[model samples]
Target chain A: MNQQETGAGEIKISARDVQVHYGDNHALVDVSVDISDKMVTAFIGPSGCGKSTFLRCLNRMNDTIDGCRVEGDIRLDGEDIYAPEVDPVHLRARVGMVFQKPNPFPKSIYDNVAYGPRIHGLAKNRSELDEIVEKSLRRGAIWDEVKDRLDAPGTSLSGGQQQRLCIARAIATSPEVLLMDEPCSALDPIATAQIEELIDELRRQFCVIMVTHSMQQAARVSQRTAFFHLGQLVEYGETGQIFTNPSDPRTESYITGRIG
Target chain B: MLWLTFLIIVAAAALAYVLNLRAARRLWAEGARLHSITTFHALYALFLAALPAFVFVVLWLALSGPVIGALVLSGLPDEVRAGATAAQENLLLSEIRSLARGQAFGEPEPWKAAAAARLTALEATEGWARLALVSLIAAAGLIYARTRVSASFRARQRVERIINGLMVFCSLVAIFTTIGIVASLFVESMRFFARVPFFEFLFGTNWEPQIPIREDQVAGAGAFGWLPVLLGTMVITVVALVVALPIGLFSAIYLNEFASPRLRAVAKPVLEILAGVPTVVYGFFAVLVVAPALRQAGQALGVDVSPNTALAAGGTMGIMLIPFISSFTDDALSAVPRSLRDGSLALGATRGETVAKVLFPAAIPGIVGGVLLAVSRAIGETMIVVMAAGLIARMTINPLDSVTTVTVQIVTLLIGDTAFDNPKTLAAFALGMMLFLVTLGVNIVALRVVRKYRELYD
Candidate 1:
């Protein structure tokens, strides 16, 4: 697959010259990428290469940081995110994020999944909220394991399970796009493999944009891969082409693990 | 003088050791080091020669100055020697020595003048003897140190061990001081308990310590029930918590979860400014502002107005305690992993929902600990109550009515002249013991909750 062919896929989120600055640091330079609907897009780069910064841009998470400024345009399915009338809070409901570490709320497993649906008034009552919780947990691929322990604290789960639970929580509101910032980095090898498989499966329903350090994970899970270095998007193409053959030597060097 | 000499010797020894080590390393690295003994041995010789010389001089100065003066006084006539105590001898010898050096001693008596001449000679002889002894002892120590020196000696390791021991001694001093305090409080409390029944004092309902002044009046008939004071303390603490908890927790939530960095920077210090204001100032505010406002409000509400109401004092105290709870809650809420909030927000939950449902619950243990600490501060508070609350120990539960706390009562009992044997003063100790025990219990529970939460989270 080539860049032109991948660009033609069903668009979920489109960014045009998205730039991010943190104080004096130019974190994300002029970058443009279109994330596909019901497909996974992976951002791969070296440490401090602004892959996570770009991911945060999708959900306006960078707004939380002081001295962070985002320029240019990011649109969710043709809706302008940076518009003066846009509410970041409401925008975050449609575009959710999962962090690198498994940070389960100190609440019970049921409450953790029910939290999103309850807050958005997605469920009518307690029983409706209960059903949403069960469905989300099941979709996250951990309901069978934690079904009997729904009342237990979310933090009581193992790392892999907690990550899955976080995924469950993220999907509870049935968000249109999911942003994961190195969700598997803090996990063990087996957990990373599990999450990679889950990401591939999640692509059937939601658009997934993953920022990862692992090239192998990008190659295995994402349909499209964007290579970043020094805060610039260097190359973006079909995952196979980005892994097997590339237009740039820098991309080749990064894919072959000769240099970050 | 001895301490100063010891300090100087230690400083010199440390300096010699560093220089010797560096010189040894250089020579050894150069591959032609030529010394029969190790480098440390040279340092040891310098240290031994200097330290003992300094210490011996200090010791001789401390001893001989008094000895020669006493000898000169003993040789005087009995009548003259009658006034020759140690201090007088020292003054007389110093005076006579100055006179012998052609200085005037006012109008010197013939016997004193004669004694002064003899004392000057004795001082010179004694000084030489003292010097000889010091030099002999110093030489012996240096010889012993030299004999102990060898090529393979581990002087640095020995010195390191001695330093490590000194560090441990310094650390233990703090622990011993705490133990000493506990022991003293325990003894004093025991002395109080011997006079009053422990159970009655613990579960008392009254507290009046007016002692009889005249012989015709009854000697000891004051009630010492402490329940009213305890109740007053509890009521005030409850009122303070009611004022503090909601404001403190919400502000913490706002700061931790919602506030932008610029807003946080501006707001945090503004909130902490409450903490920097002295409790005495808070007391003044409670008395001058809050108490009057409360009294007027009570009257408007058609309730009986008490000028020194617990509501006013406790309300101001709680405001003073807001920073404590808010800062602690902020830390606790902030400590909740970002992953949790992100997870909830990603699920399309609003920030408020994420905080209310996830962050707040997760931070419960820490928040509770903070609240507990604040409660302890409220219970042990003295100034605000002293200024705003009345001195009457009424066993009423009305908020509009005046009440006195344990701390205020203790202050009133022991502030003026009173015999230690009187129960009026002894009751203060008993009250102090109770207050200490209660606060200590709260701290222990708070620590336990915090530890349990940490273990669960980690």
Candidate 2:
């Protein structure tokens, strides 16, 4: 697989000259990329290489962090997400996020899935809300395990189930883009495989953007891969090409498990 | 003599520590592997030398008083004992004790003088006996511990066991003290109930705890109705909660969610300083400032307000309790994991919405617990109510009306040198028992609520 073969989907999110700083630390340097709709784009890098920082900029999640500042342009569907007139709350509803650790709200499983929809007012009635919850949970691939105990606390689930619940919560609002920050890093191999399969199926609807430390995960799940080094984008290409062909020595070293 | 024995025991323990440490070191040096460290052996030996001697001294001191009293009683003239009640006999014994110390209050009776001399001799003998027995016990303990400090001895385990036993003993002392207080209240309340019916005290709306000290007094038979005082406590507590809960909880929310780190650092301590203000100072503030201001405001509004109103006291008490509620609520809100807040925010919930829906629900148990604790504090508060609220017990719920709480009545009943045998002083104990039960109930409920919620995050 190469960039030409995977370049058929329309561009969904376009970032240009993006930089991020945390107080005195210049975290992410000027990086530019175009993310396509109905495709999974993976950002792979070493620890603190700004892979996660770049993912947070997609949905403006960095806005929650104190002393964190983002510069340049990040647009979602041709609209500037960082525009002064844009409300981060409404922008976040359209662009949902999943964190590295499975962070389910301390609420019931049903409420956890319904939280996003309830806040966004997606459902017209109780039945519609229930249908949305069931569909989202099924889409998250943990509905059967948690179906019998919908009223149980979300935190009471296994770690894998909790992560799936968080995914369901994110998608319940019918988001246009899904930003996942190391979604499978905290899970075992089996749970990681399950999430990977779910992500593969999810790309048919929403543009999926992910940040991961595991090159094998990027190779397995993502169609396109972006490698970051020293807070800079080292390479941007298809996952297969990034793994098999040498475009940049840094990308080759990180993928070959030598320099990362 | 007892102090001398204590000092000697301490010195002996120190010496035993040094000797045992040297012995352990010598054994280790001689290619014999000791089971425990030298320090453990030293500490074990020190405890052995000190504990048995300390126990002996305490036992002697405790029994000597009663034993010497019995001996003195027997030595007294038969005429002094004959036809004397137990109370009168106790008086004679105390007199003999005072005379024995050569601090006679009045002209000493001949029999008492002789008894006092006999008591002095008996005490002297007992003191010598105690010194000999304690010293022997200390020597025996030191020898036994020295023998046990060999290569095979488990000094560490023995020392740990002794330390664990000491910890258990200290905890037991605390538990026993609480039990003792409750038992004393129960006993005294029983005495009060004997004269006045318990039903009257509990159900009667009128409360006047005046009892005549002298038989010739004209007007001293007072009613012991507790309903009015209890009602006053309820009204004040309600007012305090109404004033405190919203302000405390909102400030807690602001501190946890909105305030920057620097603002929190500056504001939180300033709010907590309200708690550090002495209740007496709050009392003066209530009486001198809040009460007059309230009275003038009421006059300006053309609403009749008493000089000492429940509103003034309760409002000041609420101000005093703001820090308590805010700090506790702040702790609970902050304890809600950052993950929950982030999760809510990621779902497009605003900060205020996230706090109200997610953070508040998660911290509900702790918030309720804090409020309950504040309610208990308000109920048991004394100085502010005494200084600001009226002393006439009235069963009215109007905030502008004067009211007196149970604590105020207890203070008044117990003030000065009133005879404990009368109903007036004893009624204070009854009121105390009620107050204790109410606060205990609230505390138990609060603890349960807090424990239940603590498991949510974990």
Candidate 3:
């Protein structure tokens, strides 16, 4: 893949020739990307195109899956995340994730928001933890709908609210990068719109990396877009340029709905 | 003769099946659309022929013995029958029966010989009557069923109804069997309560059911307090739980969370094999191995231990119960969705913290239900306590002291030749009633806990 020229911005996460394998299946091959800080970078591809696999490698979420092996250097802010001293548990706190399905912990809404903060020791006491929870919920844009029932179970929320709750839970730890793997896939259109707006807002604080199947969603919320096809990064550039200008035939075919 | 009749009935039913199938096929060949397949009509006719004949044979077999005995008694001479008690009448009937079969001990009495001849004649007549009645009923049913097999006859619905009725009947048999057991226990317990006051049996500490075997026997009035026995059962159950619960739960957690697929495939069944070992074998192990080892260890530690202490029995019982708790707990833990585990881990919780704070709480209700089930099993366990725990019924909390459970007491009370009417043997029934109630209460609680908690995940 050719490195597209871009306006200068600080790189938050730099992946150099990353490859992932699941047993005999070659899932992602020699994928390289430089994700900028405080911007939304969306990875778009068809189903089974390794977009999600490459997203999981950002936070080491792939470590949970059996028979999955990740190789090559993935550095976060110039630090090797795969170093022996880097614990996946601690790495996940710094690189939070939102799943495709809105998987809220089977706990109270307040407890779900407080979980990451408590684990990362971000708050000193109960009041401080409550403050963090409120801030995260508000930033997730679900505070008004759920603030009254903070004590209610996280699973009791509607699909949109649960997805928002999961987002709040991820950001509560104050991570530098938020990895969202189709966070709006399981929500309705209105919920998806709310999440898209929240993603635009979250980009001001954290380097938001999302894997979405919707090309329109990538165009709407992302500053930089990476199109992955068949275990390779086919195109990476400014969102407007990738959608309009000619760079690769596969990218143009995918954008114009000719090939996916 | 009964077996021959049964065989004839079976043959008649088979012939009905063939005839009905052919009739249905003939109707279909004659350009009439049948509602059901040939097999349904065949089976319907077969059932119609077989069931009525079987019922007739069963009824005749049941009534023939009493009717023949009553006839023989009524025909006997007035001198032989005068003022005979029920027991005497039964004895005379048995002698007559044996003499008719030519198995009399010596030369039969004159009256007995006459009665035997009469009984033989009655039995032969009964056999011929039974055969004729069953065959007549089978033939009638076969004719009626064959005539009903028409082109549009709903034979399939009729057959399905019969099958549904059979299913309901089978279920009713299970329910009636349970009711029968409870009723028998209740009646026998009431009889025992008549001899020993209910309050005394429930509240009294002593439980000595001294049985008087002879008229001149002295000191046979036994105390029947149940407190010590109940306490002993509780103590042993508590000890078993203490030994089994933590170990079983932790092992279940490890097996569910930490074990690889290769290791789990081999380990789970090996652990379950412990449950498959019969309790009687566990009893033998407790008696021959565990008790002596515990006794020796206690002596070496400068503490006196009874040979049949609750510790030994309870420890072995606990070992026997480990698989029960572990398997149930493993099911409960594994039932927690993988998504929940992923959510916890993604939030950066360590594996131990994830299990301790999230998985454990989520599975608590199921785990409690499993533990309560294990408790019921421990309380009802018999062979292990009987073979290893002593016969002494002492109310003590000390595990090293020999104690007896309700089951062991029941076994001791009912063993050997004993009169059922006596309070000593009857006490077993009372103990059984208590054991049943306690276990039933535990099981109901466990079921409720499981049902109430199962909603959390769904």
TM-score of each: 0.79, 0.93, 0.91
- Which is the winner by DockQ between candidate 1 and candidate 3? 3
Per-residue CA lDDT of model 2 for B13-107, tens digit only, reads 99889989999999999989999999999999999999989988988899889988987887777877789888887888888888889998788
Could you tell me the TM-score of chain B in model 3? 0.94
Ranking by DockQ: 2, 3, 1
Q: What is the lDDT of residue A26 in candidate 1?
A: 85
- Candidate 3: lDDT over CA atoms? 0.90
RMSD, every candidate, angstroms: 7.2, 2.8, 3.8
Question: What is the TM-score ranking, best to worst?
Answer: 2, 3, 1
State which candidate has the highest TM-score. Answer: 2
lDDT per residue (tens digit) for residues B1-458 in model 3: 88879988998899999999999999989999899999999999999999889988888788888988899999999998999999999998998898999997978789889889999998899888888888899999899999999988999999999899889989999999999999999999999999999999999988777668557767557888999999999989998999999889999999999899899999999999999999999999998998899989998999999989899899988998899899888987888888778888887899898898788888888788889989999999999998899897887989999999999999998887678888888999999999999999999998888787666645
TM-score of 2: 0.93
lDDT of each: 0.81, 0.90, 0.90
Candidate 1 per-residue lDDT, tens place, B51-123, comes to 5677577677888767776777777789866855778767777777787777884788887788778877876
Task: Candidate 3: give the clashing pairs.
Answer: B206-B225
TM-score of 1: 0.79
Quote the lDDT for B86 in model 3. Answer: 91
